[model samples]
Target chain A: MDQERIQDNIDRYLSGEMNPDERREFELEVSQTPEIQRLLDFNRKLYKEIEVWGKQKLRKRLDDYYSAYLEESDLDHDQAAQTHIADPIPAVLNKTPRILGARWWRMGIAAGITGLLVISMIFFIRQQPKVELTEETPAETPVDSLEEIAPPDSLQGRSKSKPGKEGEQPKPQQSVPGASKEKMLKSQPAYALSNIKRLPKSFVRAADYPQQLQYTFKNGMLTLYGDPLIPPLRLKLFRQKGRLLLQFADDFFFIDPTETARPLIQIGPLSVSDPQPLDESIRIRLANLQESKFTQSDLEVWTGTSPQQIYSFEEKNGKRALILGGLPEGENPLVYVVNGQTCFLVLGSSVFELDNAVNQPVVLRRINGASSANARLFEGSKEFERKVYKIQ
Target chain B: MDDNHLIEELRNGNEDVIKYLYEHLPMVESWIQANNGSRQDALDLFQEAIIVFYRKVREGDYSHDSRISTYLMAICRFQWYTILKKKTKQQESFAQINLFSGQDTGNSSGEPKISQEELSLPSRESYLKNAIEELGEKCKAILEAAIFLNLKMEVIAQRFNFANAQSARQQKLQCLKRLRNKVSYEYVMSLD
Candidate 1:
């Protein structure tokens, strides 16, 4: 290819328009011809320089525009107006489809101005869904009470099945089969079971429950359903204090204390309080089941030839407590712990456990065997050894 | 939004799309400035182009035969060229080179010795920096659609409603030529 022709193809190539044959030919000439190569390099640099200059200039102009806009609208001075100016355009753009139709653009400056005005509030309000309070009323009383008042749709949507628009006849209540009305009424000791009909199937508790009884995971909540005579109760478990504070009605019923409690469970960094603590209520439940949980003060890190780092410990109370982190590097690693009287061994992401000493001691071995099991960290150990760790 | 989805929206004259375009005006401006054009030039070009695109799509003039980026790039390139010629009377050498390259046969002695790197300009970071700095929202959009998005001329033209693919192609050629003209060849060559 001649220098001029080769140079023309170079632009096409940069713009990614060159056909495969032309591209191949262009590449061939570029290697053989130094002048062409120099020319290509110059073109490339020129394109890049212009691109960078354009972006920088654009950014400066945008900043200036935004500042001027804010100033013109008096948003900079007005605290309330500042909210709109500070609202991110990306966020508005992202939500354009879900909340506003594409016609949002046609509304022009009016919509833009209005949207800007409400931008900060939109973000703040969107993050919080209206929390509906489920009024806990006694189910034993058949007569309609103020507590039985249907929550407004503004707060919580009520079923259309309710008879009468506002001051309607009370609808027939139906309790799920097997869970009798008496049993459902006595489920929660802290609050009166208001509308048993509204209770979800999973929320339905066994009619008869033991008063001073051991609780196990049923469905997904630690429910205490008993006789209606049982007064309302309040139970708050604090991890730091390691105590279970239970109050019935106005009186403090019991204070079952322990030593291993953690902060409340949080979904994200800043999110609503996760009250559904059946599986998540491990730390609090441990207080009721186990007399005391024993946790090792120091955390030991297990490192080997592999990059995997494992930390294990034990809290042997009533329930086996194993704290484990960092395991085998593949998918679906299992965790288990064997309990003993004196020592608590914890296995984490790694599916293995072992008993160790300065010399040779029995080690807990993982049950699952693999092709490369021997090559992994823990290959051999006794299965029955007491390896205790805190369970999640 | 997906390009096709956006095209549909634009065809429907969705207000949100228009608003979004207005909001991202700075991006188009940046693209223009990056390609050796000015913010004001980019604004006029982009505004006109988008409206034209909307009208075309509304009028069923555009067929979904090509990627949206390609068509819009074509229009933006053309708009840019018109602006460039008006700004600078100098005959754009890059455009001439582009026209010449199309007719000129590639290297006859086909060999594997040639490296694609030899034909490449500097990394996008260097020369385009100043232009990008001068860019507004519309310019940035046009540049990114053409350069970063690597869209075809026809698609961009259709998206932005340029007259036609050929005009779009010519326009892109001219814009690039303008940028080439502004570039300091001596400084760029010294980097080697």
Candidate 2:
């Protein structure tokens, strides 16, 4: 093959258009002719070389093109640009007196809106049916038995005593373990937690916590708040023959008076007792004095049988509602004893919500059970209506 | 260095364009030297070719009908050939050519034959470019359109307003011969 023909064939091959026969013939010529072979090899090398050089040259060209342009382009101060963006803040601040005046006007509008909202809330709350506390008489307490002790028929509708005026629930009765009601009364003015920082003097060495012990001798009611240790553990102190009880979800566990010596209500993890042991646990009655004043009908039924069988503090309305059964599997209830009067319980879902984000109540239920053990909350439509409580 | 994103940035006239070019220039210059030319020559040639390409492109004379590389290479080819032409003319000797300019122009209906001695020059890239630079403009354009752009001989003939591809091919051969002569002269000069 001649040098020119050979060059053409190499170009054809590079372009991927060489016919098979042409390729075979070209290969034969390369093998037989040293000069043509060398030329073809050189052409291949140059084609690759030039293609690379071409790109590099273009890139270098592009750079040079821009370098000259940029030096003369006239758009270069980013720091000044930042100052311009930030200028709005000072501009807003320069109008501060006017803005403050405008803010006062906004405040007036906000107050009016807030007052309207409060009025609307009052109306909405009044519209809701008054949650009548059901007073179920025990099998033995005949109606005639307590007729002399009972209040007039007009007050009979409110079995757990008449609902107090708005924001005027029964004041927590102050009853320390050893202090007499009269001494508790004499110091009541000082012990009363008008300021949240002060604890009632009844607690021997009350720690700096917002805990107060209120004991009502007339109703045998005791309320606690702040650290669980302020008041004795036996919440049944408020009820007749009241014992220290732990309610977990719908499961209830009685503090074994035989096993547990220290009555100071401690908030922490609860041990798991055998399910059967819990079943056999004795159910004690509220004190006779408390029972005599309020019939079994007036007593709120509490069945303390949570599925996990652990204990947590729960509050319903203003009353401390110790739960026995509404616990989620694999977890225990978080108990909060507030001022020794109310035990505020957060269920697992509620706990999870508080942990994950700002929480909103998703579903609400009203459950009532015996001994606080029968009441349980089954989440996600489990369909077990064993005394559920409405948590608003 | 040939990152698609950088190419995009360059096209968009981004502020980083200057820095990118500065960093890449030496590498590009080195690559050209590795490919064929000496370092200094490659740098000068590449720089000039790029500036010409950039000027034409910036002026919008480059329609982008062909690749940026192809356009730039065309400029590089012009610079390379021009340099070779100047060099060859300075040396005086008997010039050799690979093909006759009028052989394919309806000469004889037989196999186009070439002798071993006549076929001794390197491929067009190795020697043909220098040889072709010595040819007339008609031959230069004909061969350039055919070889660089890979235009069909008929298309090249049409593009140059020639009679036909056979005639175009005949013209292309004469161009190849002229390139060989220049190469022969360059070789003889180097021997001295």
Candidate 3:
């Protein structure tokens, strides 16, 4: 009843319809009585409560709207650049802004940056010296590999395998944990293939990776970005007009490359500056030995015949990983960049963007065109180096 | 449009007016940067100022005699002062900038004075902010419509599917009452 009376009195006071006696009585009650004063104060300051609440709601809505606008602005900036490219060229001085718009000034500064880069590149290339082989250099040459480092005693017993047709996905190189060391070595290279003459569908190759693995290729290297939680992927990629289109299903996302991978074969030209789309088909460009044989000093490092084959098979509790052994320091295959760090390997590929740069471990079989030596080695996990020893 | 028409449009809850105020935010940036504030700080305070202006106009507490810039700058100054006071906990001298020139800000609503109750409880604002945030979606929308949008009771009723304007009004009051209870209860608990 008191709450009702208080609410009624407050309404009557605010409405300004109270008679003189009622008004005088209400004022006197409010002035002298603490409870009445408190009630009046709460009623009057309800506006203040609304004011604060409105500010918070408005701030969030505006900030989100502003960020989205900024993102759209970035796209507009890109389109503006494309427009300039399509338009006719004006002399350098004519391009200066009469009224400085945001886009114009931005493009002008970008042009200045490009000019600076060209001048800097000229000096950098001229001053750079050729790198020479030294005692400090690891993997000086593949020729002296067997002579310097004795094979791991575990791999002393070795044998070659019967070769299969080219382009076959090598069977899983099983490690029999219960088998004797001698038995394992005798059964080494269990399924041999002359060459991995073709690349399989991305999904087929992707089966070998942890389901969380995401892959993209740049500069002849296939990078596998990792998601800690391994959330469901909503990836979209398609070939439109010879341009490979890549897009994400959602706006809020990030790709963390836990490890990067590529084939260890370093074929002709090293890396193609402009690699064409390769999803439709795989085209292998065999190295031109007559021209590229002595053109690179790396080839001269290996003048001798092929070294004796060796095999080391260690299996425990069915751990799945390709154990990369018998690799000499020089011409180490596999290159990648993850989280701003780039590790370059002599992964044999004439072109990168195309299907030529093989990231699947199957390519490790046919690397160096040594089909007989392949079907033996495979790619290892990121922690492979830590688990095994490397020749110092 | 002219300033009078713009103000009128703003009072009627035009989005373009808000965008116009933010699109040309160099003055706010300059003032914030002149103090020890970043561009982000300028944007945040400017947003608050705009909200305050919108509320003042919607509540019919703003006088038409004062320029919009004067009123906005007043709000910005007050926001910055509040931020600085919270940061230091002690009274600090201001960096010299003409936040107000004693010109007519057209403030018919009583001065946005500091309440003694607010000063007495340091954690009150944060608690109020939290309680408002944790409110159910229905309560939030209803309160926002009643208080910020200041829609007609019938319009609010239509939007929320209420039987009548009176029911909508009752719901709005209940939400507000719930929020107040939460804010004060949390504040007193924290003090103890």
Q: Which predicted model would earn the best TM-score? A: 3
Model 2: residue A79 alpha-carbon error in angstroms:
13
Best by DockQ: 1
Clashes of each: 100, 68, 8
- Lowest summed lDDT across 10 adjacent residues in model 3 chain A is found at A201-210
Comparing to the true complex, what docking class would candidate 3 get? incorrect
**How many Å off is the CA of A172 in candidate 1?**
82
Q: Which residue segments of model 1 deviate by more than 4 Å? A: A1-8, A17-25, A68-274, A280-392, B1-145, B148-151, B159-167, B182-184
Q: How does candidate 2 fare on TM-score?
A: 0.22
**Interface Cα RMSD, each model:** 26.5, 37.7, 26.9
Residues forming the 10-long window of minimal summed lDDT in candidate 1 chain A: A201-210
True-vs-predicted CA distance for residue B173, candidate 3, Å: 3.4
Candidates in order, TM-scores: namely: 0.27, 0.22, 0.32
DockQ of each: 0.06, 0.01, 0.06
True contacts kept of 2: 0.00
lDDT (Cα, tens digit) per residue for candidate 2, span A1-392? 35566656665654434655775676686677767655554444333323322333344445455446435434553432343344323445534544443333222222222222222212122112223212322122111110122121221122232222212211112121233333332323222211111111111010111111111112212221112221122222111133434432222333433421222232333443321221122222221111111111111112232211122222222112232322333333333221111122333323110100101111112122211111111111111111211111
lDDT of 3 at A387: 12
Task: State the lDDT at A258 in candidate 1.
Answer: 22
